[model samples]
Target chain A: MIRAERVTMKFGRVAAVNGVSFEVAPGESVALWGSNGAGKTTLVRCLLGILRARGRIEVGGCDARRRGKALRSLVGYVPQELAFHDDTRLGSAMSFFAGIRRVPVSRARELLDQVELDGHERKRVRDLSGGMKQRLALAVALLADPPLIVLDEPTSNLDAAGRAAVMKSLVALKQRGKTILFASHRPDEVASLADRVLVLKRGRLIEDTRPSLLWPSEAGVLTLRLFVDAERESDAAGVLRGAGHLVNLNGHGLCVAVPGDRKAEPIEVLHRSDIRVRDFQVLADYQPDWSRS
Target chain B: MSSGAVQTAVPLPRPCSAARNVISFARREVRDAVSSRWFVLCTGAFAVLAVGVSFMSLAGSGSSGFAGFGRTTAGLLNMIMLIVPLMALAAGAGSIAGERERGTLLYLLAQPVSRLELLLGKYLGLGIALTGSLCIGFGLSAGVLAAKAGGADAAAMLMLVAFTCLLAWVMLSVGMVVSVVSRKVAVATGVGLFVWLALVFVSDLGLMAGAIVFKLRVQELFIVAMLNPLQAFKMGVIVQMNASLDVLGPAGMYASQTYGRTLPWMLVGVLLAWGVLSLAAAGVLFQRKKSI
Candidate 1:
């Protein structure tokens, strides 16, 4: 549960976040998608009350700037950069955070378990891998079981498998009724996981849409490939085009683009025409407006 | 969903509990500093040096045309004053700058803690750490004295230790201010060293030059002495240890004799003023720093 109204942050002459407004409801998972320097991190810092801003910010129903401490206690923040006191063991690090947050020490073990770093309590922070360090940071943030979690590029440094594990843990957090606001530049992650995507360009919000709404129902596109004898490839392309599909000859096969969820229809069309259907895949369902023009 | 279906619960905000917050923050700082290996090494080294110097001075006094009780105490006090400030500066110069470099300051400030609490806690922590070292060093110096002269110098040693601790407090506070104001550890360390040099060496040289050029009276000379922490510290120790040394006037030379009952309080006031002013400046600076 976090709300920001007309928030603007400026550094010298540059407005890092300009008049941005958004709300994250309890138990909602929202992805903040943007390229580098797109103000996503600035927005998160403003919400956390770590950065001074021009407009109103509230976390868990408390004013962020005025009630920063209480707001801090109600929110968990995982910064993009995993920073820890290198010489301290994981357990001591957790305990220190718990002490600062006024949380019980026993919760540290539970948090370590949640991040799948249970037995790593005694390992020094410097000894951890990039992924393990990120996990430990997450565990420290979760010490107080804050109602809302803000992650700034949480999986940016993780490998493919590590990213998957982090995403899985986030999904688990969502199930447990924790609201999450994650900022990332990776498109695939946003496509697969975000319930609502907020697209930012040059410190401005360009689009806010659901994954399903991103692709129009009647305009959904599919790429279909047909395999046949080298001499018959041209004929196969003609047959598919005659069936009201756009067809083009690709290297050794025919590629067809059919409108309105015609993937099944194209296969049937190939069978009837005696054209062999080799393989089919959807390259992308939604065509971004910037590329269309 | 209808707008009426949306439910929002807002809890009343509470004021920060200053006393509890200060105590907890102070405790955390003390724990962190005391548990570190650097603190242990620095304290051990200070004790050994102070005791070794005291023993050497006592044993070699006769061959070198042995100075009397007053000069001997003055020399020992001079060493304490120098070493104590150095120790305090080393401890406090990196207190905040080191945290910023390590990226832990943000995490600490993100909590419910106020800027005042952070500054005060850090000051208190360094004070306790340095004081512990000073006490051990002072204890070793006292033991050396007892073995050499047998109970004659006990009172003087205790007084010297107390004054040296006060002087260390002033240095620690100034270093904390520099640490908070500077962004990098290197810059803070450089500035702290410069300040120590000015106070200990340059200021006294400046005072002597002024006295020579102006043909100032002995009483007027005492005014310039007040400007230097090292002078105040040394004079405070000398006056306490021996009655014969006329350094403050017929009252011994510095006017410390005339200000008898009030001199200790005055020195204390000066140290407290330094601590308070520097600490307050640091608090204000921290309140404005952008989180990284």
Candidate 2:
């Protein structure tokens, strides 16, 4: 678990993170959604006790600023910048981080496997591709199996499939009861993976909402295109409304507003109503303004 | 899990983890220094250059020549003055800057280790690595002297080596100061080399000019020499090697007046001050540096 209370970090005249407060409960996966320079990475750094801030921060119940060592042992951080010592083999780098974390050295191999980078542990960091390097970094961060993991832009450099793979591993981590706070600008990743999202803009928290509760106005709204035989438009609308749907007759066909989850049920009702339903498509229910303005 | 077991599993006390973390950082720094190719190459080059210079001096002076001891000592001392600073600079010029460039410094500092401990560990690791290089270079030089000069005085050679080590420590401290102050490795390296040049060449020239222009007495010259570690080291080794070399003037009064007395202690104080100041500067800078 991680908590921040009124945390504010400044670089001279510029505020990198300003009066932001949030928490990631144990076993919960929270996504930090923001555009570039929105202070997502800065907030993550402040929580890790790497950056000096003006307010309180606690990691796994330890005061991050005062008890940095204890807090560090309980948390793993994967930085956005994937810079590594190129000369060291991946295994040696993992072992070295493991040694510093005072964790079991065997955890290196286990984590390497967990990140699906088993055979390439002996390769130098420079030899790894962008996705492979990100995985290796994830493996290093997981070496201690810390209860909380913070990832900044974990999929920013990956292709679509690579991003999906990394997201899958992160989802697996959440399933294993590890609290995760992942920051990214990718909406699809947040939509697909995050249980709860925190939107930030210009170092300020603008919105925080659960994905299930997003787009309330559009949640139960569906657009339907019905191809009814020449004389059946009135009959189709009557039948659709009788079936508990909001129907509107259009020039092309009958458009109906059905609850997003029950849009398919209306088609079944139309089939029994003697109305010809030629084609239909279900629109995804998502609000573009879920991110901060 | 049982209630008692869950209560007992509350992670170990904070102090234990903090101590372990500091030790871990120190160990990692030591490993990095040892494994660095730049460190290996610079130290190796210093050793080879020392040995080569020593043997060349011996051959030039002839094996059985009476002046072979003096030539070998001077050659070794000169090499130490030049090579030790270069080696120390190369070892430490990027200690903090290189980590920052790699973006790993923030990662390490993010842990519970205090800035003081981080700076201390890095300085200690670099000191150890430079000391190892000094030993190798000085050892090879002494071996060459013994082999080419039909076996020189072991005690005298050791004393010179000890003095050389002291000078190397001073260089290490200077390099650390530059490293912590500069944000880029290139800048740190440039500043370190500049300081080294000033100490080895310009300082002596400036002191000589000051003494000559002012027509100062030998006592003033002695004080100026004492202020410069490189000069003091050169004079100390010269005096240690030949008692009748007339290091001062025709009367050899300055040599007798300065050598084997409070001068060594004063130089020791200078070296200690440099070490403490440089390390303190590094600690302060680290404490203030933004984690980025």
Candidate 3:
């Protein structure tokens, strides 16, 4: 479904993407796991034929350079920075894209309905919350019903519910056998969605493996179980929450959501608040050693 | 629900939706211009100015006791020069740059349409809106004149309308160039205004100052005046009206002697060239620009 050979994008003296090459077969879902400036967006833009790069790219049998319109027609793209004018109606905006994509205008209505945005067609696009806008972007991407779907930072801007909503839409797309390549920093999204994970660092593809193997080593976020003094459990939960972790306080244990590479910070946070951790354990069901250096 | 990152067999969409895509983009530009009140204000201002200037010219020339077509057109031409280009620039200058700031530009570009198609669509839409407003504004004022006194030259009035619309097209091209080059709407608009002032007022003022200071020859003055489209438009009007050379100072008189009756046609040719070249230049510049 997609092929990129030695794609390199240089900006001034620095190469944003340096000699990156990969291919995705039909019916495959690949997740590009990278931090900021890892060249994910640059690489994707090169694939879309929107940026100048030194390489060859082919999507759905269309050459990215000579057949850009055809190549773009074969892929649905969702950008990271999403925007819609306050006065632009959802229906109008969608139909506008439908026309551009050479699909029937009715496709807009169908996709919006598919995304569960049926009743809000008349609502202004900018009036939508973060989740609705993201969904709308997905719908816009899905307009062409392209064989391949590409998204940059799919769930980064969404809340928990928004992320769930986006993933559900992706699941539907996947079940239809559409190849998907998405750049994300969220481990949960990757574990749930990606068949393969491509880890990138400093513009190079450092690792390529199945999600199972990559889960423990390069997960985008981490989950830890903090065992603090019972008297200070509520205070500990509060402290974790105040320190920017999502805390789930239950009888079993206090599970605090910590991002990858920052799992040690939660334990340190509790210690600073005069709380003793009797014994803390990692609660990640898929991989206990995830985020361990 | 299926787990995550699965491929689906979605139906493929057809390709090359260029015609519909261009029309949709143009319609979007029109909607944006109208909704933002730029269209309404320009139309309203032209209407008011047209009526006021026509009546003042009619009353000022009381000896005729009637508003002649030629007299009203002469007054309207001066106003059109001041209004049409400026209004067109205002409508056009913020088009791409303003949308870029609002993130609409990149969103539109992300679609399947080509870059040239997008720019051409915008130019068509903005040109139509500006041209339509000019007709209505001038038409209303013309209607008032015909109703009050009558006997205006129908042919001459129609020619003025045509020329005015063409003039708007010329300025729209200039604005599109500004919009493409500027990163911000304010900068585009500011540059557009500067262009208007330089071409309409400052250029003429500068020429006059140079003429006085250097005591330049008539041939030198005519050559310099020919470089400006505004000067060409004015010369075309003068030639059409068969105005006397005395009022035109040395340049017009010298140009008349050098070119004879073919001078107005040459000036009109220059105006047409201005519109075509500006649009072509805009297309070339915009095609090379990288969208966000």
What fraction of the true interface does each of the listed models get right, in terms of native contacts kept?
A: 0.22, 0.29, 0.49
lDDT of 1 at B243: 58
- Decoy 2 TM-score against native: 0.79
* Model 2 lDDT, residue A232, Cα: 79
Worst 10 residues of 3 chain A by lDDT: A284-293
Would candidate 2 be rated incorrect, acceptable, medium or high by CAPRI criteria? incorrect
The lDDT per prediction is 0.70, 0.71, 0.78
Worst 10 residues of 2 chain A by lDDT: A284-293
Clashing pairs in 2: A69-B112
Cα deviation in Å at residue A198, candidate 2?
A: 2.4
lDDT of 1 by residue, B1-292 (tens): 0111112222322334666566666676677777788688878887888777767776766422224334456566667666677777767888888888888776666566666777787788778878887788778766666667554345566677778788887888888888887778888888888888888778878877987899877767776676567776766665565453374453244465567767766656666777678777777877787654
Estimated TM-score per prediction? 0.79, 0.79, 0.84
Tell me the tens digit of each residue's lDDT in model 3 across A175-236: 77779999976667887789898877788888888876654435465668878778888889
Arrange candidates by TM-score, descending.
Answer: 3, 2, 1
For every candidate structure, what is the RMSD over all alpha carbons to the true structure, in angstroms? Answer: 9.0, 9.6, 5.9
lDDT of 1 by residue, A55-166 (tens): 8999888898788777877777887767776777788778766666666677766667767788888898889998888777777666666778889888887876677777
Ranked by lDDT, the better of candidates 2 and 3 is 3
Report how far off residue B210 is in candidate 2 (Å).
3.5
